[model samples]
Target: MKNPFRLPRRASLSRPWRWLVPLLLVLLFLAVLIWLPWQARQMEANERQEQLIADTLWVEQTLRFELARSEEALAVLGADLVSKPPTPEQLQARLNQMFKNGHELRRVLWLGADGAVLAHHGLELPPAGLAKVGRETLEMARLTRAGRYTEPYGASAHAPGMVDYYLPLFKRGEYAGSLVASYSLKVLLDETVPWWFAQDNDLALLDRDDHPIAERADGGPGRGIYTHRRALDLPGSSIVLATDSVKGTPRLLPNLLVGSVIVLALGLLLSLMTLWRHISRTLAAEAALRQQMAFRTAMENSLLTGLRARDLEGRVTYVNKAFCQMVGLSAEELVGKKPPMPYWAPEAMKDYEERFAGVLAGTITPQFETVFQRSDGVRVPVLVFEAPLVDSRGRQTGWMSSILDITDRKRA
Candidate 1:
């Protein structure tokens, strides 16, 4: 009673900031981890695109360089023939020069305007004489307005290999007998393109007619060159890159570890708080914690549900059994991989990508309904919820997506 009336001491000083500080710090850390990875992934994709652009230029430049050399060789040969039609001996001497220009002997021989063997080189087994075959080859040459760069043609005994080159004889005023050279597509793929540069790359050489003459693919969807319906002044070509559905990172341990840390911390804090509470209550708390751990483990081990994590760039970095099963892709095929955007057919895929990007940019969060094609060629409907991974400071880093298989729902 003496103390009760003594004027309540100043209200026990309490600062909420103490708890807020640690909470903020952890939140900030989580945010940073999420955002940085997404940003880094975006940058990596840019680098890839840049590499592709550079490779495209390299292909064109290399072709131009080789074509120029071919033109020059034809010019010199034309001059030699103009002064004097090639005799068998002269043609034989010319074969030496052709070989020097990197033309294999068996693969490349020569034919004269009269369609007779003028000069020939390396030939263990040559094809039928292409003498006067100038017209057959000329049929393609006539279409090229560039004066150089011939069209794709079938096998020629003189040039048994498939080839793309310039026949510049037309430059000497009249079609002064044609000079043709062809290249082996296999050699170009296996040798000409460096291994590192060709990794995950698809390349194709389209003909003047815009048909794919040669193509190569590295496990992804192959590239194609489409032709135009109407005959026009000029034709066009395009390059397309395709990738399969992305794989997700392993979620079990990470989720468990994160959950464990929180549970452990809470348990310890509670034990300390109830140090004077009944021993019975403390035992109950311990039991509850164990139960939670068991539940979490069971959920993680469950194979019926699959999960995956994707960054803002649409790359799948984490995948679980259920996700892999649903997609019909092995974890090896999907994880740390990105699905090609601008979906092949469904506009929904493209819209989903855009919406995800917007959420990453902190514009707005969006739910995505899209169709994903599985490895076995089945298309499954999916619902994706996108939200930012943020830190204590509320800074956006990357995104966390929860995906639910809606294939059954769609069917229903």
Candidate 2:
């Protein structure tokens, strides 16, 4: 009989790709884990820069609007001076009203063409203080004969960092004098910078030389990590509005959310791979067991020896095909049959019964000769080998026998 438990010769033991695919997937997840945070930070930086530019432009436009309104006020004053020059008391009253209405303006002055101060409000500058106007400012006023702003100047006892807006006055197209409006940089910034913007950033007004004329008082100097500056479109002045972030830029929350998702996805993938591997191993083991059982069944079916099994109670429990043919009986008729069986020869029945009793009591010889009466009444000689049928725990549960026909050998 063939050995039923032999393994197939060509079966492979190694499966490289099984582990390699999971390794590659892990690598891909790690790449995403590293790359996604950086991408999110880049996007955040871009958005911050755009916001800075927008804020700078807004400051510039706001400053320009305030200056334009101031200039218009000065133009109206200039027109009134050209039409009907007011008494000192009347002029002082008008200047006080103008000062109350214009919170950013430090002082308003009416100067004679000879550069002498005729009247002023909001500051008690001495008559000699009118000479503080620079040569460039005087020259520009003389040439343009139009309203224009002057270069920024350092803070004085009366005003903190100042710039002067001059509207050249004319009587019948003849250059008459100048109506001057001096703006306090501190006051201008306090009014121009929006409250919302001041909450998150430090804004400063800079002069042509990049000197800060005014800055927000709410915080100390900014870190300058995110800074933006833009020029204000004011005539005869090179003023810049600059802004800096007061605190570090915040990280995007979505990046954290995305990172968590990536981690979860990686875990899910690894878990699925593990489950698949376990299932694959289970299936492979099941297939191998099924194949082994099939091989054993085939080997048993092809055997020429008659095989039989008897329970501890001495009743026939199993018989192979050869056993049925040898006795001239079908397996259904032989199985479950007790001793004094149909195939037992009448003359040898007592000897067979004694041997069976000895076998059940574990004292019979392992090999012996026996005789059975066939269906045609012929006595067949046989040689039988007996062994214990053991269960998985190695406890004997029954007796097994392999019988070989020895009638021909005896006849020869």
Candidate 3:
């Protein structure tokens, strides 16, 4: 029997809104958890590439500025030699001072208009007048009336690798002589690129044909992943400044945070699983309860005995199919009707009231006979067995009466 005293539990499994909404939320949260870090990693890779490009450009500019400074000094020295001839001692002093400031220069030669060396300053001077490159650039400068660089030459017994800057000297617009400053490409990279920068990148000098003349890889050879190139932009021949970073892709947003997010997502999934399991059990139990209620209703409806139930205050509460037929009223009309019930015979109203008062006072007669008036006003005799109604909690909350029609026995 249904427990009249028990309140209904609203959390029926049939209503899916509660767990369904949370499940969708958890799935959406997991998708973002996956996408955010990958996006962060892509952004970090782009930033690292941009930084490499910017740094390569700066190094290129720095190298060119240093080279320009040396060329300007050589041009001034050539002009001064034409205007005021310095003694050997004074000329050596000036060269020492210039070399102290700039270390890229390996040799400096002052020549007369006749191509005879007037003065020379360096660690090693070539036995021959000049290499083919130096001769060509010297002639090129004499014609152009401007300073220029020689095509790069590799290491000989005298130097690591070299290029020569030729500054043409003139007096009264006459070709007087030439000033040549030889540059060591290796020394240029060493002096121009800082230690900190070299520690992370490998620097190389490439000729017009992309042939590498000299390189510095203080950290290590590059992986060729992140690289940048800038032209040296010099005269006589073009040289490209290529930077290959030793560093690979930058790390994504930290491992700890990413791991934490993964762990939390797993935890949430676990929690959802547990919640789903509990809800499943609740649904199964509710399903079983509903099936039992259905079976009980079927069994009660099949009985020949009419069943009636009332609350503690003597108010009618439940009437099965048999009870409705016996009282000659529909269950809906008889279920909530109080004493002075429509089914009570008019002549037996006094007895019905006394018995209802006894039921409310916790005193019920076990067996009794009564007359009930049918809906057509025909009187019928019936036997009734009354007992205290106990709920599922085992507490008596009302009275239950079973009625059996005795008209056939009376006729026999």
The TM-score-based order of candidates, best leading, equals 3, 2, 1
Give the 10-residue window scoring lowest on summed lDDT in candidate 3.
1-10
Could you tell me every candidate's TM-score relative to the true structure? 0.42, 0.68, 0.77
CA-RMSD of model 2: 6.8
Per residue, candidate 2 scores C-alpha lDDT tens digits across 180-202 of 88888888888878887887778
Predictions: Cα RMSD each:
36.9, 6.8, 4.8
Q: Which 10 consecutive residues of model 2 have the lowest summed lDDT?
A: 1-10
- Per-model CA lDDT versus the true structure: 0.51, 0.80, 0.85
**Winning model by TM-score:** 3
- Give the better candidate number (1 or 3) by lDDT: 3
Q: Output the better candidate (1/3) by TM-score.
A: 3
lDDT of 3 by residue, 1-412 (tens): 3334323666676467876888899989998888788888888878878988999889889988998998888878887899998899999999998898899887899989999989989956657768887888889999999988887877444545677888999999999999989887888999999998898898898877777778889999987878888988888868888988887765654689797987899899999899889888987877778778777888888998998888898888888888777767887787677778888898999999898888867897899999999998989899999988887899998888899999999999
On a 0 to 100 scale, what is the lDDT of residue 207 in model 2? 82
Error of 1 at 48 (Å): 2.8
* Cα TM-score of candidate 3: 0.77
The Cα RMSD in angstroms, rounded to one decimal, for candidate 1 relative to the true structure is 36.9
Error of 3 at 90 (Å): 2.7
Model 3 alpha-carbon drift over 4 Å, by segment:
1-31, 155-160, 208-212, 251-253, 266-302, 309-317, 329-381, 385-401
What's the lDDT of the predicted structure labeled candidate 1?
A: 0.51
